[model samples]
Target: MGSCIICGTPVEGRICDSHQEDVVFEFRGNEASQLTPGRFYSGAVDGYADFGVFVDLAPGVTGLLHRSELDRRLESLDWEPGDTVFVQVKNVRDNGNIDLGWSIRQSERDFRGALVQDADGDHEDDESDESDDAEAEVETPTVRHGSASRDESDESNESNESGKSNESNESGKSNESNESRHQRDEAEPEPSADRERVEIGTLGDRVGEEVRIEGEVVSAQQTGGPTVFEVRDETGVVDAAAFVEAGVRAYPDVDVGSVVRLDGEIELRHNEIQVETEALVSLEGDDADTVQSRLDDALRGRARPDEVTPLADHDAIVSVGTQLQDAAEEIRRAVFESRPIIVRHTTTADGYVAGAAVERAVLPLIREEHAKSDAEYHYFDRRPLEEAVYGMDAATNDVTRMLQDRDRHGEKLPLVLLVGTGATVESSDGLDLLSIYGAKRVVADAAAVDAEIEESTDVLVSPVLADADASDLSTGALVANLAAAVNDDVRSDLRHLPAVSYWEDAPQAYLDAASDAGYDETYVRELREAIALEAYYQSYEDKRELITDLLFDNGVTPDGDGENAGNLASHVSEQFRLKLDAEVETARANLESREADGVDFAVLDTDAYTHRFDFPPTALLLDELHRREREGDTFVTIGVAMDELYLRSTADVDLRAVAEAAREHAPEAGITAVGIREGRIEFLSGRREQVKEAVVEAVAEQLA
Candidate 1:
């Protein structure tokens, strides 16, 4: 028996049952069944698949590291064939399939005790160099000088002189390369050979000519014809394709995040610039450092803007300016890194206005950062949510799509930006699901804050979080300032969006800003109505071009001359007014009035009085009705649908306390508080009458 290496407790072998996971084991056994479940195993990357990667603990014995098990993302991994990696053996299936999970300690040096388990016995791994075979794995950022092994700066390290005339040119016999390398080298010289390096940003001018460029390989995708390496330098990024045989990965050593020198002919294919690679070599030591330093400097310089200054003078905005600046930096950095951004917002007028403002700002920056034309569309996405709460159903759908994209197209995990839709206790489960995969989540609540959401999100920008009053702060105004911070080039396009968001009680600062930008109060109202109408129609699609025309297209030209400036807004707004007026008139005829504790309540059974399937949704209809029936100082509107009850009041009404009171009064009503911000409550349809009366009494008791 041997004592546990971790805690010094007596054990059967090197580790106690309690501390078995404390040590990392290098499995030297040939059989997959020999791998103990729940033990960390040192393995080598065998290959990749759509679902996961194949990791071999020993030759001919491999385990599957499913993408779901990864902490970050599968595409984010820079592992190549034969690179040593660490993973925990989760399970051994009956079919001899070994399931592997992500290990926090990837390197052997991170583990406290590194052990080796083989057929003979268990002992400490003397040297972790088993995968240091003659495989061309780019494991480290150090140059290889006439060396075949991944870790070696082997015997007689000098330039080859087998066919040269000078004495310095000739050297002793070295470890020769395999037939594949010999054949590949015969077609093209090594990339380490002396050549003039050029910037990728200048490649557009040097098209149809051969050039050498040094950069980090951001992506390496194996296509049916060739393997395309998206190499990014300090200046810009470009795709360089290397071909071996059909459907085979060329330059298997090069991978994502590898600093390399590549030589190729710049050519235009499908109207996009591509490099037909002749030679590519991984750079190391000083060479890699020079390229990496330049890239880092460029990223910082390009991504970071000056400290944010609020456009309009508002105390709340001034208080949250730091969070706004941080959100802007995160967005710009994601764009620079070529990471996809998914924007989620409610399908309301404020949500659409805010989401569209950010879209306008980011599209221009995407075009400037990436050379490809579709990079703007591919990288920036805007998704509208039916409800303000980002629930488990939405999070599940997002993760599934992200995983599929990573597995199929080798795309990076998206930066999910929740605008005006992720600041509530209801959104915690959704954020937790995203946090599990290390997916970056930014919650731009703008109006309010919740501690539950704040605890889960990576970046949260809410006025209340900064100890500022959000009573007058609209979500649109907050996000417009944030969008301007992201890309100040499109600042002019966002000048009028904030004023258009407010239906009433708009800050005069925003109104004057809109008036100065050529939008009068009437024009702003028309634009708001038009967007609101369109927002509900699709309610899901971004409607990019149409929204842009209404908000930015007319004002785009220098003269800003367009007779049709108000044509679309006037046309769409007419329908918005007609549909809304019709819904209101129908609801007014069936309104039920009740007075309790010196408070007046306007109750409407939305199911009977309102066109359920038509425009001006139940909530919006109730809000409009409440506004017109403000005869009394203490007035409230309670809209009762089949199974849901919505409350809107000029006075403060605590939704949670009201729900509790109703539950106490009508215990079998099964009343539940849906959301505080939404002022929503749910009840059993069978107890709808009881729930409606109890809720009205509860609200009157508080407002009295």
Candidate 2:
């Protein structure tokens, strides 16, 4: 038994099974059965197919590397036939069919050791023989186009090799290690004439050709093998790998957001083009300014649309459309810059529908901007808040996650988005936290916002600030407009969301738009109820696929188009009605009648009489209860829990003014208004009885 080269542990081969993936292999066998899974092997592109590509491991042996096994799109690959590449053998079936997977490490020099494999057995590579016939397909040194000619470099290397000690020459060790040579070479800048600068997007076509690339380092990640730098130019981004030692960071001076010029040879790694870096240096002066200007101009042209096209004919929405366009541009810019987005919304139907609509639109844009298929998940996130308040806990959680990501993956700070929330004074502290860390904050709400909120947020798109009627729009309706502006391809899918958002009276234009989009009134209503019910159970989870299915991708339903399957929304809506009816009935049984200041009040002790955590919460139950208790001309329904109470009134209710007046009546109750739109107030539970009565009297007197 030999010792594993990596950890010095005993193994059956030169590399232990645990560390086998770290070692790459050269296959000499002519049969597929001799190939071992989990170890990477050198291969050449035989050809492509509709489903995948065929990689030739040997003269007569080949393996199928399916398109799904790739980290990037199949069409994006620029490899011509007979190009040397690397892939892992995933499986060798009984029928002699071989399956290959992607390998992140493309070059044999990147691994600590390269092993030789054959039908006989596995052994270490013997580089001294240098047999052209036996290993006819051995690696060829990539030629640097404009640098020292191949003849000169070979002569210089041979002279240096001849001067080396006899022991070092026989052992096959170089005079200078690759890392020290790379460090020395990178210390000096080469003349611009030595290499032609190339755009990152064109690197795929220039594989094995040495060139210089200039761009900003967007991300610098360190792996077990190499330090990978993601450089973004105006056209696109490409990974540049630099190696000093195993698990050691290369070019530590080069960091994220730095504009640098990288000199390297292009190679295909895992079907995606990567740069094997020889030298990387930061660019400054006119060159840096030129690159920065080009990137900014390109970003503005590609990320921002000229104008916002409202899906429906609504004057109120149009009046505030420009601001929505600005918010959309910011969101698009974040995606292009490879920044993560945290979309926080309330746990209501309007919040879920709004978040889902924006999510659907943003996801496709992420896929288009990034080469990786799973970039959508890494770039875009939708988090639901338990309440509308974005407090310390939420902001702290966001900070913790962002810091961890930055340290581990060299990612940029995320953009914190508040949809249908973060417009109140309650959200100020959270916004402050995000601002301190330079995280962009956006508030796209339809409710009246505190004056302080507008000044603090990066982008605040609200009817309250736009001088329009806030009552005419629901949060979902307003944010759906924003979602459409983010991605116009998804505009048709969001037409019915506005109609679905309204519980009672929706704007006629939105209703007409939903009808035009083939969603009848009944269907939208059922969908709204279903989202409301589902959104409540998992109040914190994103439930991305489930929401997508309900909104767009659910299979053929009985009431929906095509052959009959089943309508998921209608079945879920049925439960919504049943549960809501039960809660409202229970609330009505404990209702107390009160008459003061010419107002009739229907009050219920929520903590003592109703289910706390179940469906049809205080707000929904009180809404239904107030609609039923129409015994008087002016009626008010109040649900009082241990420390909080909800108010719904037929009369005008100014929550802030009522809160100030209520605090006066109960001086030590410590009462405050949580949500102005919802008429929610919180107080000391020890003084609940006095606080509830005080609020009722204060509100009644304000209207009286």
Candidate 3:
């Protein structure tokens, strides 16, 4: 069914529009145009071209023309699918398809003159080439030559005859048009002849250089000579050595996926490019490298340090499965000459796969090695990790210092931290809890902890939770909670794993915690205000208890624990605020109505309150104003829920600006402040005061 153009409502007559005609076009090619030209229409471009034009003019009748014919120019001339263009009919080709000619380029002479010059120059060049070839053939082949071997007597006679002819030709030397004849005699420039080509390999006698070698990156470390990359590109492995500019510089930040290109002086001892790396370039594409780098920076313990820096003594990197055990051995050997001892777990297939990538595998190594051994882990519900150390001066500052210290010992570094979504860790010292060492750690809350368990290999388990019901939640939650509980339940016997938790955004809880821990009320308020401001721009309803309960209010839900009763108070407060805002908006709109129409209105008939009530002094003045503004018959337009006073007058009120202001002020208020057109003033849905204020503002701005 056809709908109204602007509002998309069902149309009855001419679609209540101001436009003169509907835009349409002729169909061409594979697509058929459904509308007529010069009318508003909507469709997609089936095909277009490079010369600032599109081909298929009408759906089935394809043509070409400049886009300027459509009265608009493209910002970027590059064409792609989904771009729209407009055009008008130009010419109809003999092949039935319209030839959409475009003269958007100013002056027809400009194009015609340029084409003529090009054609003339080409013709002359072609004629000159032909004459040169003719002259060359006539001068060289037609002259008679005397040969000695044929006959000496005949040769002597021929030479004597030629000498006589040369003397006779001297008599005809001065000819007419000598310059033209000389030009004709010039030889044609011949094309170059073909030559045999030689292969690059034939130029050099190379031994090991001819051998194609590939190796996977085991470790990029310098063992005895220059920086060496131990890669296994698979064709029996190779240690392609890059020396100085080639070796050390090529693989500065080398990782597992780095593909090394080795074409240098090769030694045949091991069947690999064994001379120190001569030239190394990372084979990783820019996009892949960028994404991996960012992810790694966020999760690692330090920002990228020098590839050879002894950041930490090669320690045992915890991993699971045989695949990781092999990887860990490679990693540890590269980091510390010894192979890293692998800590295997009975991991699921998915778990083993998720941790297979180098990105996820390196984080726990950095975290366990970096964090303080005695770092206390607290397990509590509601507060984020950052808030847990909110007021602890020394601890908070230390965490913040480490977070902000991107450079360690003058070298930039990133910290690797494993975290989940919605789990923010803010340092008080202005350091981002997320270090650029690896992936940004965003630990999701208890509800959405499934992602965490599916990601890590060396799953840290809490000794305290050794007796807890791990089966109470999904595998994801079990992992997340176990991590959380281990980090949280720090006591004498359970001090191995650190704890992590925060109270929900009930500013009062933070304040209480601070006060009980010896913080003053003022300090508590400052922190409370900081947290409360997070919700200021949100709508009142968003803060309602009912909404929060259905959404975020459940910081940690108890499985099978039925309805949550804590949301009742928040729900009531939200309702109260919503009602208050509505009432305020209604009162203001009523006052605005009377002010705009030059009337001091008062209610006389309660039932007709939505209407003009009674003909009081204010109502009468409003009528007079309406008479001064409208251009058609004066009457009331009534609907089931609303009433509008419409009138036709011949006077000028010029309240356009006033009405616009009213609409802007109380968008949700039912009363709308309106300007009298022709001369009548009227009010739509809001309170009078708001309408009056808008009208006054509109008038002031107009006059100014």
Candidate 4:
């Protein structure tokens, strides 16, 4: 029996079965089957392949280290042929193929002990000879007692041999101990003051050279090999990879948004400049405060515009500049903190255009802020709602997704941005649900805002509340300005989007801005028609990338076919006009024109006259039909449904006033203004005929 080297427990060999894995072994077997599974072995690099590397364990035995087992990218490996490495034996296949897994520690000194595994599946510790010598010494006393003075010269010879064996074992152990200590010392890097501090933007000039940098950590993630910290200084952001112990987290205290001082060498990683951090320390006390202040100052100077610039020369836009600034700041802070931003917009051409503009501006910022290439997709999302109201259904879906992301990925709660939606009283309940979980809400809609909605959201940008004509502005125009405030770089790209939202009669200022940005009138018209057609097909999807291309990309393809931008728009717009014309003709033929309560009324049973499941939606169809029918007459067009009604008027009409009158006139029917800006009303389905009669009379009285 012998004592285990690690735990000092008695065992059959120098180490117990439990401690076998703790010790690394030098394999001396000549066959692959001689190696034990789940044991670490010392090997030398035989060669490399696109899929994996080949490691030689013995003279003629080798194993394949598949690329999937690698901690980092296969190409990042610096190992050369014949270089000593450590790998774990994962399996020995039935066909004698050896599979090797990656090991963090490449040196035998990193393990508790070293052993030699023979071809017979037996382990021999390097110190086993010393233990044998000690046993001989113990028995020598017994021999002396048995034969007091007999064979003293033989005993002396035996004692000398034992002493030499012990000396050899002690010397080997000492060398291993020294090597381990040296490796540990080398792993801990000391910060040097002699290194010059450089901005991240200037790292291109310092590649392959040592550098010192101080910045705020934008994000941090632990990969198998190192903890990658994305630090943003005044100039720009760069990734710093700090590896203390391979596959172990280093600088455990450094977190996202923390101010840190790092010393490292700049190396090109995957063709991008990255700092392989040698020393990383989180600043504390006055140092931390100073670094934070410096970052804040720089962010303010760069992120915030000198003054709020209105997109158009309008009183309402000028008045809402402060609110726009607040919305922009919230978005910028979310990006800095690595919180996901969720945009909720109505499923309309104007709404999609508005959301896509913001998506374009914010995605670039997310990419710049995160080290991972897929960060933009993970951190920013846009969901389209079927209606212009943020109801319980939309709120429930948002909360579910946010909770899932938070639990599964440890993501921060997102910022819920309601673009071209959520400015009505009906959306307050949905906004409140988001607030219960500490999600920030911002509303940017060119709609008549309700007082309750302004209170429910953190920031509300509604020009109608500032006495602006809601009819003169499109939601796309309003949110395009908000997107510009969030990211100034995309401001020019969004110049044409606002004008494209209007089917006709866009504001002169927006048209001029679009022209200045090189989008002619014909281009704007085609883009608008394309978006309108696309919005009707997949009313739920945001179509983020495709819409961005159609709206912003120049009309030139790599093949020079001039079929990139306007090609899709031209084809889709033709379908839109044809389908819409057919629907309008059907609706007009079914229209019942009459005079009710001294008012001209145009009423149509939309459920029977229009294709509810195809082409333009009920709200959009009513809007166009009303605009074309009510040329000079001050009339009200009503698209009546079983349980709801969509209204359009030549003169300004208050749907809420009509809803209140209908409730009184038809006491048994429950009526409410579901979409105020859309001029929509909902009533109990059971009281359909009674509610219709009451609603027509009430609207006529209000118009009168």
Highest lDDT: give the candidate number: 2
TM-score winner, 1 or 2: 2
Q: What is the per-residue lDDT of model 2 for residues 1-704, given as tens digits with 9 covering 90 to 100?
A: 87554445667876777557755677999899889888888899999997888999999899999976775546657678999888999999999999999775554433434567888777754541242132224232222331222222121111100001111222355434576546534554443557778887787699889889888888876543345677888777776766543233456567889889888877765465777777778878998998899889989998887889887887778878888988998898888788888999988888998899889789888776654444676678899987777888998999988886675457889988898778888889889999999999989888857767977799999877777877778889989989999999999899888988888789989889988988888888888888988888867778776677688754124322345667788888899999998888887888999988889888999999889888977777787788888565678889899999999888778888888999999999999998775778999999999998899899889889
TM-score of 1: 0.72
Note each model's CA RMSD in angstroms: 15.9, 10.6, 32.2, 15.9
Judged by whole-model lDDT over C-alpha atoms, candidate 1 comes out at 0.75
Q: Is candidate 2 or candidate 3 better by lDDT?
A: 2
Whole-model Cα lDDT per candidate?
A: 0.75, 0.76, 0.28, 0.73
Task: Report RMSD for candidate 3.
Answer: 32.2
Superposed Cα deviation of residue 522, candidate 2 (Å): 0.9
Cα lDDT tens digits, model 3, 1-704, are: 34322122344521223221211221322432322233322223455554445544434444555544432333233445444433445545455554343322221101100100121111112332443354346432211111111122111111000001110122343222445334322321111223221222221233434333322354443211123344442112334433221001123445445543433334432131243333334445663465345434432322222122111111111111222222233332222211122111112111111111222233233233211111011000011121211123423433443333221111112212222222112221222322222312222122222222323322222211223332122222222222222222211111110110111222233234334444345432322222222222221212222222222222222222344434332344354344334433332344222222333222112123333231211222333333333333222211111223222222222344445564677554443322121122355544544544554445444433
Tens-place lDDT digits, model 1, residues 473-555: 88899999999999887777788888998888889889988898899999999988888888888677777766776777542
- RMSD over all Cα atoms, model 4: 15.9
Give the per-residue lDDT digits (tens) of candidate 4, residues 1-704: 77564445667766677656656777888888889899888899999987899999998889999987875546657899999888999999998889999886553323545667877555554354454354345311211110111122112111000001111132244212444445444455556678767888788788888888998875564332244567777666777766432222345556666788888777764456777777777788998898778777877765555556766665556777887888888888778666789999887789888998889789888877664455676679899888888989999999998885553233578999998789988888999999999999999988757866887999888876566656677889888888888888888888888888887788889899889888889878877777887887767766665576577665322222333433666666678888888999999999999887677888889888988888888888888888888845568889988889998888778889999999999988889899986788999889988888898899888877
- Supply the TM-score for candidate 2: 0.73
User: Model 4, residue 6: what's the lDDT?
Assistant: 45
